[model samples]
Target: MCVHGSNNNPDIGQLLEGLPTNWGKWGPDDEVGALNYLQAEQVLRGIAAVRQGRTFTLQIPIGHEKGEPLFPGRRPSMRMNVLDKGHYLAGKAHFDGNVEFSDDVIFMHVQGSTQYDALGHVWYDDKLWNGYDAMSTIGSMARASIVPIAERGVAGRAVLVDMARHRGKAVLDKGETFTHHDLLAAARAQGTAIEPRDILIIRTGWIGSFYEREAAEFYSDFVEPGLTFSRELVEWFHAMEIPNLVTDTMGNEVTVDPRSGVMIPLHAALMRNLGVAFAEVAQLDALAEDCARDGQWQFLYTAAPLKIVGGTGAPVNPLVIK
Candidate 1:
């Protein structure tokens, strides 16, 4: 079966109904969906949270040099170094006293590592964000490209809802999931409030497991512990007007949906339909540690995807400052 094709599940259409959506809410030419909520005031709020000069790099290094990517289709990046070998270094000297250095040529899958999914990354039916035809819209550089995200960058107050810490466990076991209530409870426990335009980062302890076990073992079975996808949770995010989100899981949502014949349903709903970007595979363990130690979960979060024009996604090195 084609992964991108519409599901045969009869209730799919009904499931989408009544959920909040921002289609045309900004304008007919709206490219970034809920991201428009992160305005000057929101940025200022994030900046004000930086009480300490400490910074946390939220990205997993690109490619297998660090660790293997869990996604099968996404390959690790390749790098080729070109060393300095000029005529001045040889017997046939040309320059008087100049020397050269080395550079590298890198080939990478944009979403292969810690990365942001562009607004044009996913779609349902024949449509994309703001009801544009998927084929024509994604075929060109007209709308929903990564360039806009790169140019603007994401700067806002980020709230880390550590699910593992809330449940008093190292990680949620396979097949375990958390609900919207659990998220709120976790935020409350952390003394952080989910606010409008806030960048939400949900920690599932999946990355912690990756660190504890063999890289191959962690990447072996693709199971992931993540938020339970429901109308309530998705709609709550909409009502909250969250601009963007990050998660340590391979996919922001659960690795596999409990419902049969559906995969990453929230990905389609949020990115394709809602026009929200997602930064996945974030290195959140250190940030979570620091938050728990300091009793502060709010921080200045910034992420900028590579400026690959008309790309579907690009690797990102997000930062959290406190």
Candidate 2:
């Protein structure tokens, strides 16, 4: 009989009973709810293993897409200036000049390029993550405006799912959207199975075209080449309870929905709804090649964003150590 309860739904019990006899069983008293005694024991064991410091880190660099200039119908260009003040020896004495440093310049604003977007960076309708209003949450501060991501330093076993190798191509089409099935297929192709709490690093091979100014052109209204995660994919990540999702692309998702002409929905679903921090604009071309040759997807990930207080996002230099 199927018993329905809001707090303790007995329907779960009936569902478990329908499983094959060889399947494990759990009692209400001996076991904690649906998790059987053996399953719970395994969970505790896994927790202990994680506490023992068995993990790797991958560093992903934020590309030069953000520093590019935006001119109508002009190819994007990067403009960075360095100011150095030194001493000149004059009359057997060193004379120091006035110190000055400036990188104050305007260029094309690549919203997702090498950026860790604050919770206020994007909002769903009117509500930001954790029910914080976008406008209210963002102000003069840059880094601290969002949650303390860098403070904790996301650490975990990173799995690089190389989609480019699976497709035998360098870049996925600008408007292509990646579904849950596509991700699974890519993983299977690489012979790497994604586990729970694993930092999923997706390499779409888009960073190669980043330096190709002509091919990687930015349109005022049109979409660009990148992978868009489907709704199912977001749910899968949540169910798996992964620590974070890192990708090598501008937005980590296709810019436009091929059918609906809308922008990335996965960003909202993953970052806002699931509280999943996304590491975007990752430079993964070289890392992908190494992983493909070595047949290993693990890497030590390290990324430290500028400590810009009360800011929306900060420039980051993420690196990967094998």
Candidate 3:
């Protein structure tokens, strides 16, 4: 028999029965005092006992023609082809040598698509997370570059929060945003629970429609659905103590912010403050469908970023194993 929390027959009483007797009376300003008062260890152990086991994986291709405009007018990629090459040895006998042949040489210059941002990629107003300056963190002549992240590949248990299914679609459409409540509701609907040390992979299904258009039409505009994380959401993830986050969009945040005039507070808070890692431009359509059909949501997630020396960001091929 499986022991779990259910939306229909929710154990509401059991869920809140352990609340501290003095919950309402506890002072909000007392940080250390609060820690001394709560049963933190016991609560954590209880949560650990009920997690389910299931597997699903998502794949994100790094070089999509539809992603060209992500850099806004920059050439998407370039390739140099080597037509032919021949090598001859001097000490040869039937005219004396064997001819060495080489085929076409190709180099990929990547532009749009999902990528991993190095710690050195962005600085907070001028100060980097670990005290490295922008100049020291990136290359001077070559542009913003950081050490390769492929050397340290990302491997973790993944949890999927299907925002698109909750909204009744394969695509979330441009300009739609997901809230923290939507995430919790989706997990509840899927019969799974999130835990610490997990890699949270949110699927908004924005990338699914990329291939519907012609190559030129797809590359003309770069727009996709994304999630909007509130400060509350950030705090929740921090409290959950997850190692990283991956999402099926270019960046995790929604494209526009009405108040800040900037689009990425979640990135600022997660990367700059919490030091959490993130994978962007994920492909989640297939994975979302699988989870919807099976009602299972965990997966073994793996991703390897390109090993570009001192690169700000590098393309990745992320895979999920069941």
Task: Return the clash pairs for model 3, or none.
Answer: 57-320, 92-96, 93-96, 145-310, 146-310, 146-311
lDDT value for model 2? 0.53
lDDT of 2 by residue, 1-322 (tens): 1212244322322322222221112221110111111133333433443322333333332235443322124344345443223212223223358334434353433333465555445545555555555556544532224335544444445678877777877777656567657877888888777776666788877655556546336433435555554445655765676656777775667765454344465556666555566667677777777677767666555556555556565556665555
Residues forming the 10-long window of minimal summed lDDT in candidate 3: 29-38
lDDT, candidate 2, at 263: 48
Q: Judging by lDDT against the true structure, name the best candidate.
A: 1
Which portions of model 2 show Cα errors greater than 4 Å?
1-113, 141-144, 213-222
Model 1: per-residue Cα lDDT over 96-203, one tens digit each: 467555566887777877888878777667777787777755465567777778887898888899998888887777556787798888899888888877888999
RMSD of candidate 3 to the true fold? 12.8
Q: What overall lDDT goes with each candidate model? A: 0.77, 0.53, 0.56
Sorted on lDDT, best first, the list reads: 1, 3, 2
Clashes within 3 Å, all models in order = 1, 23, 6
lDDT of 1: 0.77
Native-vs-model 3 lDDT? 0.56
Superposed model 3: Cα runs more than 4 Å off: 1-73, 84-111, 138-148, 214-223
